[model samples]
Target: MIGTAKYLFGLSVGLIALLCFAAGAVIDRRPDVPRAPPPDAQEVRAALGFGQMALILMGTSSPVSFTLPQAWLDGVHSLVSHGKDNLAMDGRIDGRGAVFRVSKRLTRHGWLNLAFRLEETSAGGAPRLILYAGGWRAPEWLTAALLRMGLPLLGGSQELESLIPAFRAEDQTVQMTARVPRALVGGLQAVLGSGEGGGVDLELVRAIYGELLAGAVLEPEPDYARIVRRAAMQVDSAEGLKAALVALTMFTDGPRVLRLAGDRTKTPPCALTAFATRLHGRADTPKHWVLSAALTMFMDEKTGRAIGLWKELDDSLPGGSGFSFVDLAADMAGVRIGKAARDGTDIDKVIAGLRSGRPEIILPSAVLQLPEALPHHQWKRRYGPLEERRMMRQERLIGNLLDRSPLYSRLPPSRP
Candidate 1:
């Protein structure tokens, strides 16, 4: 009986061990590995061409990081060697890296300006690029170009939302900056949590931008004083204040608040009446208290305190580093204040000059220095380098077209 018992026990143990081994093997062979991107390899290769262009415009040292499959880099190389529709300044490959410039026609205005550098995976296992925001004027346009090339910003896609938590680093805050309304509170909370001395909550700032883009009509709570005090506590740092200015000035309607032409098609204005009104004199508020005041004036168009507030802001707010929020606001307000002869000519300047209550028919200036058209064949001879040559050629062509086209003549010239 004892011998029989021992044999049965030993057999049971052996069976259990075999079952464990089989289960381990099945798990090992499971198809659950992380994928790089869009299922089509060919598409990824095609995207490399555009990615290469974005890399040059943004730069190798940019704060924004991107990781692409090695295959994408290989494909970009193939295009550079053969593609004729490529940019005048074709991308150059360096060991495990690439650099290039990209230019695009801005209708009759001018070509889009950009340059960048790209590198293989960093220690974080993704390619990285640096954007000199100081020089980067049209971020939205640049972002669109990158998206066309299959490179979206981090935490930028809805399909990738579930995977976001896994991808986020320990210290990284949840980024909610998209044209989504649900993320506003979460973003606000993050910014407020940063406190007086903490780093600016960039993620939160992005959330605000998302709200603006969606043309959110924020209805303030009954306790206006409490909310305003809370906002003051949340955005105490200079960096935080700057972040607010950036988010606010880059209005959802477009770059500038005012419409260039008098179409009377206005975007539904952001509802800031309550918050701005309440925030007027809250203690320990942002140094640029006028920011809130300005918001109220923008939405209400009262101009009661707006004109005086503008003077104070224009005098106090420092300039000369990057795109100015003051300039953006001024344009939106349609208040032109340059030299007498140089009021309105280029569509951009005209857009800037158009202020609230100003007449729309400002004439083109007499000193209008339109670009000189040069023939394509003489591109290399007249322009010294690749960058200069391409820029000059495009400008000249645009200038000649402007001079000849009836559209240019229809535009009103500067008065007096």
Candidate 2:
């Protein structure tokens, strides 16, 4: 009876060891694949269906596998909170790999589709987050053309930022009976809300938006229009920027692409800067993680100086609040922040690590936000103050650009 019991116990222990070995083998056998490059806009549009736009690619590495579904869901929720879309997933797992489907509205009549997948692939031998979107292709050329035509709107470039402010009509203290397309609301808001009885009155703001639109005197620039249309058709190739002029064009011309890029301004718009700063002082309202991460990255990039891209990012939140350049470029691009928790990682360190060793920091080419453009040459090669001459050029350039706005003369000077 004792001998029989011993044999049974040894058999049970062997079975357990076998199960462990199998599980370990399953976990370790991810493919040795490399990360994919940024998909060509035309190709991505084709694959995801052309009706959708905006691609977010995140990349990271970890010895332990993540709960990918949870991470993806968290990402989607974050985006939706920032008004990307109310997204749902339809997915399935096959041996060692999985795929997810995501969709959203791009316009009243148009919808966008996307596909998300997880794989053991790396870019330059590092893991990457792969996202694909479908919609009307608004390429860099189109943005540049629009800018030259005085649209003051550019999207889909990490080097440029959006200048268009978002409109929140429902938040108005005083309600107006008429309803305008949500697309047109932002321009109208910008026009109406320039400066009123006091600071940030929504009703007064709406009124200001209307007055500015009505007061503008505009003329046709055939050359600018021709360039824009051509660029829209051949977005992948257009590089040099033609001079886009400032004219109050009707927002009703076509679908208003809310994702816009700002001109090369060295500082954030003063109003935005002040608004973000005020949030820091409010005890009732906790600062957002995106804002916190951006501020942290901005400070690190500025070398502890309270200036540069971080300040601009803080101020620009009103135009498209709730999204962070760091989130889009790094975390969403797949650098697992949580994985580095034991490495004493924080937002500042993560940003510093990513920006280091690269000739230029590359940001995700999403709508509304992009990394502040770096100088073409060796950025670190400067004497005294790094990039001082370039900084002067950017400041002058932005000043001239802002001066051209119809609302510029009426708006109170942004805090210097």
Candidate 3:
């Protein structure tokens, strides 16, 4: 009996070890880079199709891969972030990293089809792009912040609920109203409940949007889609921005192409800074792994996708970084932060170690001007003081370009 029991125990131990070896081998396999839909896969016959797709190169991760158009964009950028803010595409945020694909046979008579994908796979490798453009406004807090910082904003106040009375007509539920921009007078007249007091702000903001930003005042009230089409005609039409955000935006339903390249001489108005999005929440606080892991974003939803890469840290883990931020970037860089394989024992050390390399820090393209732009609320939301110092120091590298670009000439730019 003793001999038989020993044999069974030895057999069970061997089986367990074999299972573990198989699991380790599976994890060790490299991730497969996604390829475009096959040539015969109906996109070619259909009117809607992507012009190009290709695996670009590896970024901050060892196992993680980057992809873009086979051709390089004249304007390309790379940078890092500690995970804050929404990606500002035309006006649509590619929220939750869900796919923002578009198809527009634009028939205005019926109802607007709002397609929201709950599945994250749909928005793979794409930042959120605008679907319909021309309606989004800088929120009042942001406006006040920017205005206080010295932007040429027309006007706004902190009691934003009062400032934008568009939905207060009958004390209804969260009503979704779509304003047609071209028909300015008609749009204003259509204002439901807040009376004349609200009309002026709407008209003023719309007019400025169309004129100073959009560069063309609409003759008649046009639907949001139409407004986007009209604005797309200009080199810098404020309305043109919408097409940049959503994957399938329409200029009267045309497929606008975005090329990605590394050359720094030129830039796309819509291109974004590539920042590292860490999802362990604030490492400074303990007992935060679950709350941080389940984070839901309120504004600028694209941060959701950046976090999607790290959603596997189940709520029950005895949480903490097994590796420092820097070390994790090196060790897990290429590994998919899948459900079974996230949450480290030393995340704090990993972060510190990676940064400790002391990479020559740079600024996000949006607020590269530093302390001078620092005072502006628009600038502050995107960049803080520590980054501001980095930006200030780095400007010397692009001093000549800053001197020549019309964009910078408008700002103080000089060191404070």
Candidate 4:
């Protein structure tokens, strides 16, 4: 009787293990990953043009509404996801709310899927977001409990409701309406618009290209300061000048900018191709580093994406030089310069300072004093991502240095 009991017990244990494994297998089915298509130059240009137009329209007091097609959303998703193929998103509007489905592929086999609906509910006569229909491959009670715990940790629904005033999802398109501050609208207009009208001036763009070609022949080195000065000089209006400054940032770091834009065939004539070659050489200068930061900032703004996160990840990995505050300074300086271009508050002073051919005019020499690199562990311990205190201190120091400098002071105030 004892022997028979032991055999039955062993069989029951094995059956339980088998059942657990089968359950995992059911949840972990192979994920179907979609490949991102290559970017088309025409589509990119059109999108930029439309964005610029939308900024101009938003300058008015009235609310602005725009519809984004599924293709554009897919492209944006691919871009934000870094084309990892490990994650995907699908969203649509159902009735008064919107539903978003997100899926992540597991390392070995299955996909972890979560679907949620966002519906606006009235709370004390104000609109607020209520998350509904949220679940994954978990029990209903467990999923609900997890969502309830996670929502507050992710800034609650208040943040989402504030950011998205009105949203409508459809099978093929998503329409959104937003109200932007006048200051932001004015700044965008100053940088993106032509004084004669709302949209960018074709003549100004042609002149910029013309100047680039002319500079290539006239100057042996890719002197960006000279190019920017000359481009700014051609346009009489403040808006035109600001537009030129912002546009010229693309060529400042030509190689990386081209790569980011998916333009492999065409190269700017202003020794951009040669300059790209020189960047990898031993003779590269601090100016090159500063220009690269500026290009990164410009690209970030243009695409509404953050490439710096990728840079930080790459630097933090094994065999890398780690994080560098000097790089941070350069990034801050580049962002300040971009802001100046957009504000156009001191356009004359900016133009005058650029002609001096001194990189210190933009990136202060004080930045060289900062620590070169810190390993991932040290960086995490000392200064983690989005750490408010460290960021505020750094911004204050950089702001003070830029404000004290004659060249940077000529531009608008650096508001962090």
Per-candidate Cα lDDT values, in order, are: 0.31, 0.26, 0.23, 0.47
Give the per-residue lDDT of model 2 (tens digit) for 127-190: 1223333322233343333333332222222221222111111111111111122333345333
The lDDT-based order of candidates, best leading, equals: 4, 1, 2, 3
Candidate 4 lDDT, tens digit per residue, 306-409? 33323443465456666666665555555555444444446667666655555566456676677646776776566554324774566567667766668766
**Top-lDDT candidate index:** 4
Compared with the true structure, model 3 gives a TM-score of: 0.16
**How does model 1 score by TM-score?**
0.19
Summed backbone clashes in each candidate are: 19, 33, 41, 2
Candidate 2 yields a Cα-based lDDT of: 0.26
> What does candidate 4 score on TM?
0.44
lDDT by residue (1-416, candidate 3, tens digit) is: 99999867855655554344323322212211112221111212111111121121111111222222211110010100112221111101222322221111122322112222211223232221212212222233433443232222213222222221222111111111121222222222232111111111222222323332232232542223223233323223112222221111111121111221011123333333321122222222111111211121111112222232122111111242321222212111212111111222233332222222121111113222323312223232443222256433443434433334332233223221
Give model 2 RMSD, 1 decimal.
Answer: 25.8
What C-alpha lDDT, on a 0 to 100 scale, does residue 135 get in candidate 2? 23
Task: Give residue 121's error in model 3 in angstroms.
Answer: 28
- The better-scoring model by lDDT among 1 and 3 is 1
Provide the lowest-lDDT 10-residue window in model 2: 240-249
